[model samples]
Target: MLEDDPFHAELVGSWLRAAGHTCTVTESGEAFIRQLGRESFDLLILDWVIPDIAGDEVLARVRTMLSDMPPVMFVTSRDSEVEIAMILRAGGDDYMVKPARKLELLARVEALGRRRSAGENDIIEAEPYRIDTAARTLFMHGEPVVLTNTEFELARYLFRNVGRMLSRGHLLESIWGRSANVNTRTVDTYLSRLRKKLSLGPETGWRLSAIYQHGYRLEHMGIRSREGAAAAE
Candidate 1:
């Protein structure tokens, strides 16, 4: 966590530690960038205004330097629409207004942590599909499936959370690294591409179901009941 205010830093750090996460709090953006260079982190909680440099500038630098950039959340008093848009455009995964509630903060942190954990394994297998994380490749039925970098990441995330309803916001945050100021239509477009490319349907025993007013779930076709089928239809 990069926070200039000592009190806020300690408060946030304690909250994270209580949730069983190890956290390092930095008082300046310069120190935060230095720590990032020395160590890798799963998530970053940043304050927009810092002593040495602004958080957005630090985020830009991090993006340029790191290939696998960690999830970043901005927690700051600056809650204007313009500021929020700018921060998200600059690569923040999530944005929170200052004096964050403990429960919401913990929830967001846990969500980001889950995304990181899901991505750590080098190889992932879901029956006919095999994913090679190191090479960023996907294979199905012993045959290779060509996927762009974004498409591969999206497929991996979906496979990792199979059977769970994943909100478009969650997918956007986990894959694109920005939760706010993004068009959910982008997710719809990708899902369409994935469904076509991977042959996801009843024939394959896998179905990506879009829940009305909710989100999407990747699940086995057999598990969906007749009523569920009717509703989906």
Candidate 2:
């Protein structure tokens, strides 16, 4: 948690610890960034204003450096609609006004943790592609494929809803959190990255299709039959 106010930081940190989460509190954005470099966190609770670097700028730097972005919640006194929108657009997953209620804060944090944990507990299989949710790992044809955290989550989500058309808004909310106000173009950019990284195409026995006036879908190319026949020999 990156917070300048000692009272709020202690309060939030205590609450998180009571709820069985390991909590780290940083009073400055610079310290937060340094800690982030050495540790991987599931969630980031940030204050809009900090002693050094502002929260939004810190978030931007983090997004630039990390491929598997952690869920970020801004806890700040800046409650203006414009400020909130700007923070969300910059990739903050959630926002809370200052003097936040303990219960609500705990609830949001738990929800983010649960969502991330859920993604890690199940395996999604699409023939050659094997995704281990718990391990956050992917394999293609028994060979491991390295995916950044966000990429792994996106690929798993697509595989989970295979053949289903998911709207851009739905994906943004689902993956980035309901509070995220990111543009649809962000989804397009990530989809392109996923496609190239995973080699999603006709020859790969999988197709990630874009629907006109709709969204996207990952379709299996029914190559299992060929594999089955070849195995029979």
Candidate 3:
């Protein structure tokens, strides 16, 4: 853990040890960088608001230093939609808002550990859909669906926040990394394309819906099978 706050660091260290993890706590980016030069760890938990150097910078440096580093869990107090999106785009594996529950912290840590152990790259699956982040290809119902980089990022963001309604600003900043250059129209254009590609059908419970001026959400309609059409008939 790289956190400047002693209390927070000790609490997290205590939790990790209780969970049977061998953890080391450090208070500054300089120390962390020096430690990285001498020791290797299974995973890293970084505080977003750390002093001396920002947590995002630490992650970026770590990536360059280590050919293969473990997953990272960002501990942040900023819950702004834009901040979270920025963190995710900066290559952070996952995030947790500050003052987090003990269980939630542990759960996020364990999840990070699992992803590290699995040695999986950018490929991910959510039900019948398969996304190869590296190949920049998506597969739905065994059919190939091509997507532009923007469309892919938009879909991936919505999919990651499934069942949650993101605001327009949140979507724009997350997908584009900043809102100064674009508007919600860009988000809508890509969303239309993603929906056309996903094509959940009546049998499948999956659907994407726009929440008025807010943002889009991925939903499971709870309907399944081609028989669903017959039942409706």
- How many residue pairs collide in each prediction? 0, 2, 2
Q: lDDT winner among the candidates?
A: 1
lDDT value, candidate 2, whole model: 0.82
Candidate 2, superposed: residue stretches over 4 Å from native: 118-233
Tell me the lDDT of model 1 at 81: 99
lDDT of 3 by residue, 138-206 (tens): 777667687778888876666655565566666776668642688778778877877776775554457
**Best of the two (1, 3) by TM-score:** 1
Tens-digit lDDT track of model 1 for 1-233:
99989999999899988876668898988888877655446689999888789888989888886666779999999989999999988889899998989999999988877887776788888867899988888998889998888899899988876766677766876788643566779998999999989988754668898877556888867645534665676
How many residue pairs of model 2 clash at the backbone? 2
For candidate 3, give the lDDT of residue 134. 76
Residue pairs in steric clash, candidate 1? none
Worst 10 residues of 2 by lDDT: 224-233
lDDT of 3 at 7: 88
Superposition error at 15 for model 2 (Å) = 0.8
Local accuracy by lDDT, each model:
0.83, 0.82, 0.75
Compared with the true structure, model 1 gives a TM-score of: 0.53
Clashing pairs in 2: 120-133, 120-134
